[model samples]
Target: MKLYLQYFSMLVRCQMQYKFSFWMMVVGHFFMSFSLFFSIFFLFSRFGEVDGFTFPEILLCFAVVSMAFSSAECFARGFDVFPRLIKSGDLDRILLRPRSVIFQVLCSNIEFSRLGRFLQALLILIYAVLTSGFAWSFDKIIALFLMLTGGFVTFSALFILYAAFSFFTIDGLEFMNIFTDGAKEFGRYPFSVYGEGILKFLTFGIPLALFQYYPLLYLTGRSDRIGLIFLPLIGFLFLIPCYAFFRFGLRRYQSVGS
Candidate 1:
């Protein structure tokens, strides 16, 4: 954790060295994400609620997923760019370092610019909370916190798994975006709204629904299942297999000889 902070601070200073470019990238991300919000806004304005979910409820869902995804992209961007290390033989240098390989990779890159999207999501979250119409309670608050934490963990794990795949392909796979970026976009509505098939896939296959949909049911009072409040914790469990897969990939890695 301490080393992570040092990396965080160093990166912040380095990025801040170019304040104009940094702020412009931040603003670009903010408005780019707002476009998706507008799409939802126009949809709600035209039809006024789809699948029995109110605009504010959808906003909450969108905000949580966007925040989680953006947070992951910001911090775990190293994994997203892992193919570069393999291609350039940077992994050789990384392996020689005394630190944990995962930690070194984690420290290799961080996208503070993605905070723009996070800020946009946070603003929408504040708005949704005010207009969601459900009475807030201690349990509800805890559920919300867990949803964010779980979603962050789940997305980060996906990044790691995506990185693992690069060991075989030696190039970044775009299809994985279906789970990372696609999840953020489609998650504007509860996963349940998609269909039972996708919902089950997300729940059992990817665990996206574990943090977003099930806990959302509890937040919206659709169900009082106390268990739903804690389902997001299941997302943390996803990290184990993802890390193991990364190690498996490491074993099979043959350097590109930079």
Candidate 2:
């Protein structure tokens, strides 16, 4: 943990060297994500509900996904930018360290700029909690906390999976955004609101719903199934396969000419 902090501090110092650019990037990211908010707003303006979910419920879903995604991007940014690391032969340097390769990669970059998105998500979350009309109980509050943590883990795992895949291709992949960015956008509404088919896919396949939709049902008082409130923990399990795939890809990595 000390080493990680050291590296993180170094990265922060580097970012501070270009303070204006850093702040500009932060503002740019805020606007880039705010556009998504407008998209949601426009949709809700046209229609009172989408697939039975109200505007406020959809806003809550968006906040959860956005917060999770930004948190992943902030800390796990190295994995998100793994193609550059691989192409630049930085992975070789990381491999030589006595520390765990995954840990080092995770610490390679820290995007302070993503805090803008996180702030936006926090505002939306506050609004959601205020308007959702459910009385908060200890268990429900705990479940909400778990939902945030679990969502962060699940999204970070996806980013790591994307990084792992990069080792084979040794290049950035655009299609992977469908799972990351696309999920954040589409997830603004509960997976169930999409369709039974999409909800099943999210639950059994990617398990995005494990962190968002199912727990949300309990939080909203739509269901009293206490069991479902803990479903986000299942999302953490998704990391196992993602890590395994990354390790497998590492074995296949052919160092680029230095």
Best candidate, lDDT: 1
Runs with alpha carbons beyond 4 Å of true place in candidate 1: none
Model 2 scores a C-alpha lDDT of: 0.89
Best by TM-score: 1
Instruction: Give all candidates' CA lDDT scores.
Output: 0.94, 0.89
Q: Write the per-residue lDDT of candidate 2 for residues 1-258, one digit (tens) a residue.
A: 898889989999999999999999888888888898889989989998887778888888889999998998899999999999999999999999898999999899989999989988988899988998778889989988888988999999999999998987888789988889889888888888678998898899888889999998888777989998889998889999999999999999899996
Give the per-residue Cα lDDT of candidate 2 at 52: 76
Candidate 1 lDDT (Cα, 0 to 1): 0.94
Candidate 1 C-alpha lDDT tens digits along 161-198: 99999999999899998999889999999988789999
* Cα distance off (Å), candidate 2, residue 221: 1.5
